[model samples]
Target: MMASPYLQCDSEQKLQCHWGLLLPPGCVVIQTSSSLTKMGCGSSIPKNCKVGGKGRKRHSIIEEVAVFVPTIRIPVDSDVVHPLRGLVSKELVDRLSKLRAHVVSLSEEIFLLTESRLEASVEFRWKTLDDDQECCVSSAWYEVLSVVHMLAMLALFEANLMLIPKDGQVGGERKVSEDAKKDVVDSLLKASGCLDYSVHHILVQIPAQVKKSFPCYLQEGMLEAISIQALAQCVEIQLGLASECEKATLSVKRRLACELVTYFSQAHYCLSGCDTSDSYGKKLLLFLKWKCMEAKAVAYYYHGLVLDKGAEASNHISAVCCLSAAEDLVTDSKRACLSFCLASPITRVPPPWGIMKNMHKKIPDAAYRKFQMYGYLFEQDKNSAHQSLPDLPEFALSLKPEGYELPSTDSIWDNVDSQPQIQSLKEHLNDEEDEVETK
Candidate 1:
């Protein structure tokens, strides 16, 4: 249950609009008293006007809201990633639902505001995990929709990490209670749902012309990796619970491990389409590889146990080989884990807490037992049969990531055309712009 250090937001766009002459004469801003509301301007910006050309500042009669986009930072040179606004966890889903609503409302507002060039585009700036600088995409409102969704999902995931229960010490006895695990499972599912929408739904809505140009954060491959990463973590947590249960069978544990391997390997494969040139990508690849290797260790160990129950000599030999492979994989994964921590923008690796932590205790002892069973046979038979690792049995995944649907367009958009004063305001603003440019 390790959390990525990449959290927080430095990507901000101050969104302010003067509505005195924009929206219909009586239109008032919908949001109030929150991050979105505090910045929402209900009238003219005070600094932009001075009473009788004196120094006194007061907001004019123009009703408006100041706008801001909280973009997450991508720290390449430093290891500081900040969380979005506050812990969005308490109201996160609602907050996210409102984000699309806000974007929809803003798009309509912008269209009315930009009477001059209906071609005016909103700039969406964000950064990928590996980059030092923020990336910008200016186009349709869906661009903003897509980026905001990514940030929301990321926030949800980071919050879920905070929710994970920690045992007092890192040891072989996995004693975390089932009740605690249940909550994290719910959070993980929500995170996966956001990720599911990011790649599958919202992404496709982005205009094709600007789609390919989006930063790695919005790209299909990276989104896929994050999505699967969430699922992998969920499966890991579930496996931890299963491992702790006395009633659980060997097959059930192996099934969970095999599924974990499925997610980690798929996530690693997604990285193939991404640009691994950046420090983040490189570090991520190492992490995925570590996870993949670790999953294999747990999977093979449980598989060896299941096979050991069979009656035939071949079964025993195969079980011995599986156990041996599991031991070697455990070693390999440890090395990979160290490499991940030592990568640039270095940070401490999370202490082993879940399945791998418990497996560490079991693999050596189990392998010892398997080898002990085979000792007499090797001594009795001069020519021992060659034993190579057998393929781990594949099991159908017990879990599937939930799908997400974007909220319907904000209700405010329904009355966009009904605002008669909007046209006159656009012409008025345009006329003012023309006078300044002409002068």
Candidate 2:
């Protein structure tokens, strides 16, 4: 029989295999033939040489594979830019730096245009012989309004610069310094004093200078009316708290309010002399009267503000009279004048509902309801009077109705040179603009 391939023998036995290289020391091997013969190669084999022996371990291939693998981290991108990078990307910073040189150039151009317009308007008014000294005073006050409008427009233009990508933060962005605030307060007070002086000058000068020259008898009265309107407008403009003015413990607001009332009262006395025959003058007079009425209305509404400090009963009564007169005098046409006059007395002294019921004459239901609502809003106690301000159907009493078209005054004035300067002034201020920025 042929020997097995795994079998090992000595040199004398054909040297088929060496037992030392074929298996671990002490290992044993078995050989068998088809006739049931068996052979062993070694005996007393090492403990580890046996399959499933104690102290032998199995290892994982996954841990060995992970040892050589590397790890990586990823991040997300967000696109955002800082605010002060004026109209220029970082790539174009050098090119955009030129904008700083021209910044004040545009500002000065706008200021000169505004100043020219004001000078022209003032010159025009100065030449009008029909206007009295009081009219001149009113005309001069236009400077204040014009200046404020100019400042506001400038502020608007500067605000547009915020859209521009700025290279660096602009100066003057922080609150004004203490010294600056003091300077502003001093300047404003000076201006206010000038206005007061102007009022006095007109009131004293106009009656002496133009009272004799006027073709109409009501010339002095008309001047007084215009002065009142001017004063009221001034009060409205300056009544709001200014930044520096707020720092001071004292305010000019109350004095301004008193002056407004005083001027309006004088205007009422003057309007009594105006006549319908003087159409141009009468129209102006009517406008001034309307302004006075509005001022009085506002004054009356706020009259109770000092009640916490214990105002007198007579003051309350006078306040009621002012409010009632204001309501009655608020008119659109001369046709309503007689009705207004008749309604004035009853409105001044509003009686109880019982008294209104006992009246001998019949009144229109709508008119009576309207007056009742007014009384409830203005004449009644705190809560009830608050309801009187706009509760009435204003449309019913308005001269101009909804969807109504009126002829343009510009068409009539097209041939006249009077309003050209004003038109030019408006156009200059509103000229083409792209962008502006402040802090």
Candidate 3:
């Protein structure tokens, strides 16, 4: 065999340059896109292109050039290789764990204090007090509820973070151990319980206390704001419960879905009075109303899932309708949010008395991504089996009794005639435009 041109060359670079020059003028030398492509090209090249062999044909030079020419390859990270690479730091996890424990302890302390105070009252009578004293009592009560709310929020964040693998891998390739799954479910259930308790205290207990204390003790605006806050919290907890119960038994999942739907329905009813006209309070209420709608969309999506997984063959059509309604709700919510953001000024306003400052923080993306995921799953498999419950007795035991009781759907439409006349989005937008023009 004739000595290969590569062997005669002083270096590989020279051989490559020579081969490049030997190629036909019109032929293009395209850079390979990846390492796999390069390897494929290397393997498929003609045998005559070997280092010591002669190429009898001119086309052999082109094949030799394709094989020997170096191509830049970018390294692609694979979740299979490093599943837990991007998870939160160990120190943060430890801190969150400690904080969650402390919150639970503090909640117990506050609940006991409130219970004792309630028991001491005679016919829920309030002691005669001046305006300042009444204000002090109101402030104290608001502060306690606010603290509980914040703690529940913190616990939720911690629980979600904990569910992420320590190795940072969130991809499906990483098979979660039974112990790890159990731990996650337990943590989430605990967090949901804390949130539910706080919401109940705010919505039911606080209102009863206010009623007993004195008329006008809590301002009307303050009471309205608090009710809205509690309702919002209720929606959040239900949505979280629905998410955590996704891998639970069909019955458990269905119960969660039912609760979610009921909560969403109630939230919608509460938000009916939210005025979106001009003031800061109205703007905040408008934002909250959009949030309620978004939450309802997610609940409907879950309800659809439950129906699809059930044994009834008729449920498939119901599932499709539920999903369709969810999509419409999401679209409307987005439009409402956009309109509210555009119409409302960014200037901060003093919150109404007893309403916490934290309540004004910008609302998060109203469950749009979550709705999309559910939609995708429904599209993928309308008949996919319900998720099997993990083998965790503690998780099962931790499920709150409240979820089992379904809310009456009739109550949702109760007193609908009494609701204030709220204008449609277009009319509201027009009113805003007219206000700007008058200015």
Q: In TM-score terms, which candidate is top?
A: 1
lDDT, each prediction: 0.55, 0.28, 0.34
Look at candidate 1 and tell me the lDDT of residue 17: 33
TM-score of 2: 0.26
Supply every candidate's count of residue pairs whose N, Cα or C atoms clash at under 3 angstroms. 16, 15, 5
* lDDT of each residue in 242-352, candidate 2, tens digit only: 212555222233344445556556656766776535434544444455445544433433332222123644434433444444344333212232233233121111111
Encode model 1's per-residue lDDT on 50-132: one tens digit a residue. 31223545443222100011123321111011111121121322333343244333321211122222212334343432223
lDDT of 2 at 105: 17
| Candidate 1 residue runs with Cα over 4 Å from true position | 1-120, 127-132, 141-148, 163-177, 378-386, 416-439
Model 1, CA-based lDDT: 0.55
Per-residue lDDT of 1-439 in model 3, one digit per residue for the tens? 2221112223444323322221112100111112112222233333443311233332222111100001111111111101111222233223323322332222111111212332222111111111111122332233333333333333333333333334533231223344544443443343344335444444454455554443331233333343333333433444344344446564554454444444434434543554324343455455556655655565565566666675653455456556666667666776755654554343211111111111222112223433444555546666755321111111121234122111112221233442334457886677568657755
Q: Give each model a TM-score.
A: 0.68, 0.26, 0.31
Indicate which candidate wins on lDDT.
1
In lDDT terms, how accurate is model 3? 0.34
